[model samples]
Target: MAYRETVKIRDRKAAQREALLAAAEGLVREGGFAALTIQALSARAGVGVGTVYRYFRAKDTLAAEVFRLATEREVAAVAEALQHQTDAAAKLEQAASRFARRALRAPRLAWALIAEPVDPAVDTERLRYRAAYAALFEQMIEAGVRAGELPLQSPTLSAAALVGALAEALVGPLADHQADEHVVQQLIRFCLRAVGAADPTAPEVSHEQVC
Candidate 1:
């Protein structure tokens, strides 16, 4: 009987933790990270303030989790998209397209995730997630080069460059909420060309698609 009671208690605690996290995420999605205070989170999550603190002792910890949740979801989407294609260039294009589209769909959240100033903990999360993106791109770039579909290049440097360029390019668009479908397509083309996927002779991604 004691074991059964303890199991129920653990299950309830897990559910409360999940609720707090979801509430934190909603706060970020609606109003950026500034609104993610413990007080706010508790009310939004329908839990007591102490309960929120019990789950996440600090705001930055919760904020970092929020960033990780969103970023990891995007990485998964891109990874899944890459799995459907065999061609290196197509893989790159799909990855870029999915990433841009996802950003455009949520400009405010994208801005917060990509470049918003935040606590050191949240920034650390940003760096980690950015590296995850770069690593995925590196794999595609390396594959393309070996297959002769892309020119010789340092996958490490090139992938890092691509991730940096794409994030920087979207900064203003996301800030101004100008991230339309057109801008998203432009980013896809720009990334593809930068990685040698847009060889002038072969030109897999055409100017129209790019523009």
Candidate 2:
């Protein structure tokens, strides 16, 4: 039937698109975004140039999709890590460490998602994702303030500053090589101190105690 043929064609196109994305991700993992080219990707993916063009009109569009996929994975990891920990400081520490570790594990992908030049539409979406992340930290900071553990006058600003600092310090090591856990811990401690935590060296505080 005509309808059945149309459905089969659509399914085949979907599979091809998925293949292109997978091939792009592999290229990015092996050699970074700069190494990705339509010709190379099409060849690697076993697709014709026209087939690749049918999926992504431009290289920037494909790059944006790649960035989106990478960022979604990182954000999900951060959200999952935060869910298991309740205390503000503890959650912050866990989140930072998890992010750093993930970044190091996928440095090329991280650099593409976070550090590379992206299309305007993709940049806007990225900003919204970052704002959501910032809001989660703000809530944690507010809980710390209520518990008399943090001296932050403005939770939003404090949360943003801490996140920005952690991102900046970790990005370089993530791009170039492995980051030292001790250094990551030290950065965590510094963030705790900045928020007016009495002693970063003290034993971990429980979520119940803070709540």
Task: Tell me which residue pairs clash in candidate 1.
Answer: none
Tens-digit lDDT track of model 1 for 87-108: 7878887888888888888887
lDDT of 2 by residue, 1-211 (tens): 9999999999998988888998998888877777678988999988789989989999878877876776777778888998887677787777777877776777777666566565686676667667766777788889988987777579999878877777777767766676776656667766766777643346664554232
User: Number of clashing residue pairs in every model?
Assistant: 0, 0
lDDT of each: 0.86, 0.76
Best by TM-score: 1
Error of 2 at 124 (Å): 4.3
Model 2 lDDT on a 0 to 1 scale:
0.76
Mark the regions of model 1 whose C-alpha exceeds 4 Å error after superposition: 199-210
TM-score of candidate 1 against the unseen true structure: 0.94
Error of 1 at 182 (Å): 0.9
CA lDDT, candidate 2, residue 119: 64
